[model samples]
Target: MTEEDSLRETRMPSLRIMAKNTRDVMKEPILQSILEKSILTKTQLETLLIDLVIEDEFENHISYKEKASLRSKAASRSRGVSRGAFNRTLNQARKNITRCFYTMLLLAYLGLFEFTFFSPFEELATRIEGYRRIRDTLAGKTDLSSEEIESYQSAERTILSALDSLSTSLSLKSRLSRRKTGSEIESER
Candidate 1:
């Protein structure tokens, strides 16, 4: 088999698993509610979820051939989806997710502050503080040193980005093990 073929052979199962996992996540009540409240139609939400899952799975593949094959698979799967439409939907979904998260955090912060005599919302308060610091720095209200700005950036990247990276890593590992088992069985044959 050509290298491209071999890579695809290894990656197809990964892609399938990624799609399944994405579907599972999308079926969650929280996600469903988020989708309902967002601008994305049902079809657009489905497409965006699948694309995110597949893209995350393919993000860390070491070889260009593997990446290209995966991208081709994604393109074919999303056939008839205009690049502009997909990107717009994806961006909207991201904004919606972020807005939802912030709203939740705000509610939690308010509740904790209202109910507790002491400072029970320390973690949430810290997050809010960090968010404000970043916002202020960006708005030129706070003159952050380079290191401080980097620290804020790192903190911001840790939340959503880390979750995404962790999910991708977990899914890739799961699929790789399945691929190895399949390869071993084929070799035995």
Candidate 2:
């Protein structure tokens, strides 16, 4: 085979693997629930993940054009988008991420983090990391014993339960919709 043909053959499998992994991650239950509640839109999340994958998978820096092309390919886009479109989405994703951090900072400054209400968020973060570790360990193995499969399933259920609990805690009540006038606030003080 010609050098060009050989290169194409090797590149195809890695590209396919990247596409498959992207799809699988999007389908994950925890991620699906989080995305539904997240500030970033689904398209923005996909764009952000693709950008991160490009940074992590490439040892050397690549041009924006190349990054955009790879991002499209990894996302399994039928036709690659122009670099401008991809860059726009990436920028939106970054803005949402920055805003989220700023909001967190505001909450901390208000001393809200000291309350028990925010403790679940910290727990959820730790649980999510543990879930990822369990998933990665299982994903690396070609074959798994029944015990390993059961252990992974248990971990999945535990994380899902924790997520559900957190969701319930954050849900707004009907009474919370009532508007209080400035006089009412002063009266409470």
User: 110 in model 1: Cα distance from truth in Å?
Assistant: 3.1
Q: Which stretches of candidate 2 lie over 4 Å from their true place?
A: 1-16, 72-79, 169-189
TM-score of 1: 0.34
How many steric clashes does model 2 contain?
Answer: 0
**Pairs that clash in candidate 2:** none
**How high is each candidate's TM-score?**
0.34, 0.74
Query: Per-residue alpha-carbon lDDT of model 2 for 9-80, expressed as tens digits?
Result: 565556546645775788888898889878998777877876777457644444455445555444565635
Clashes per candidate (backbone, < 3 Å): 0, 0
Worst 10 residues of 1 by lDDT: 64-73
Highest-lDDT candidate: 2
- Please report, in order, the local distance difference test score of every candidate based on alpha carbons: 0.55, 0.72
